[model samples]
Target: MSTAAERTTSPQPMNPDEEAFLRALGRVMTLLPRAIDADMMRDRQMPLSEYTALMNLSEAPGRQMRMNELATACMLSLSGMTRVVTRLESRGLAERVKCDEDARGLNAVLTDAGLARLREAWPAHLASVRRHVMDHLEGADLAAFTAVLNRFPL
Candidate 1:
């Protein structure tokens, strides 16, 4: 067990520019997802995660991927991926198939209906993305921004 003094450490103070940058990053992180998710739900009748899952599966070979791979690609927990898959299945948009190479594994497959739904939502999704993000990036120094972003370990 440690006392308060032992458990506490002073944080290095950030300069004003650093502080402003961090605050702006925080606001963007918070607002971006909410805006995208709200637009998707309102227009697509599905949340962003489900759309992401569909999009990922649509791009995969055979329009299918192992559950673990799908989960990783979607940046979702296994259970969260499972729930999203279940919801898609209920909507006849996706199905789970037993992996041919690994009986213990399952694959998520995009159905024709899923593709159609994706097509239906594509316009709105693209428009929303353009409005919220791509528009802001237009004619900007993307190479520099990309390089800076790539410097981060994430």
Candidate 2:
């Protein structure tokens, strides 16, 4: 087996194009969610995180997911997902139920209200996504871009 040092080769300096791409990726990572969230909030809709949670729940099998799985799917920490689910519960949009197979675990289930809210928010969300992202990618190879994105660890 190779020693740790042998396995740890120095990374090459980024080329100018690579540097520019990295900078742009960083900016997008920072700005995209804020832009989408602002658009949603400005329109008197739920924030992007809540919308995302609802959307994920709406698409899950039986419109429910285990809390931890939901958190992973929503790119949130478990505690963060709990907070979002709590906000949703207060609004009658979602509820937490004891997991059927695992009594110790919980699941987040979307209510009819949540589905309705998601439907209401969909148009504005789509517009925001288009304005902030898709429009900029006009004529770009989306399949290739998606493939490149899939290379990253979730």
Candidate 3:
């Protein structure tokens, strides 16, 4: 087995092919989010972040979860989630609840209205997801594609 030094010093220079691959990967990463954003714009007038927050709430236990936890789940800061939750609350999609179990904590609960919005949005969103991702692969390749995504770092 090669030592770490040998591996690090291996005369291999990541040349044009590796460079091009990295660039292509970066481009795909940049573009896919924009495409999803466009889909959200057309379907429900929801921004991607808001829609994502709603989806996180939808998947949570009892369609409700603590604000701090929801923020982390959606990769947003607490303040950011608070702002988004305010917007959602104004639209009747979500509401802030006094955590009865903890006087100092708060939770976000998706309302029936939120479920309606999710129901309205699901067909278009699922179609977009399939169009952009799932529909491109064959049987085995589909499994492999998901496996790769599952292993990706957060």
Compare the candidates by TM-score and give the number of the best one: 2
Clashing pairs in 3: none
The worst-scoring run of ten residues by lDDT in candidate 1 lies at: 3-12
Q: In candidate 2, which residue ranges exceed 4 Å CA deviation?
A: 1-7
Q: List the residue pairs that clash in candidate 2.
A: none
Judged by lDDT, which candidate is best?
2
Give the residue spans of candidate 1 off by over 4 A: 1-12
Candidate 3: Cα lDDT at 31: 88
TM-score, ranked from best to worst = 2, 1, 3
Residue runs of model 3 more than 4 Å from their true location after superposition = 1-17, 138-140
Give the C-alpha miss distance for residue 134 in model 1, angstroms: 1.6
- For each candidate, the alpha-carbon lDDT, in order, equals 0.93, 0.95, 0.87
Clashes of 3: 0
- Clash count per candidate: 0, 0, 0
What lDDT would candidate 1 get against the real structure?
0.93
C-alpha RMSD values across all candidates? 5.0, 2.6, 2.8
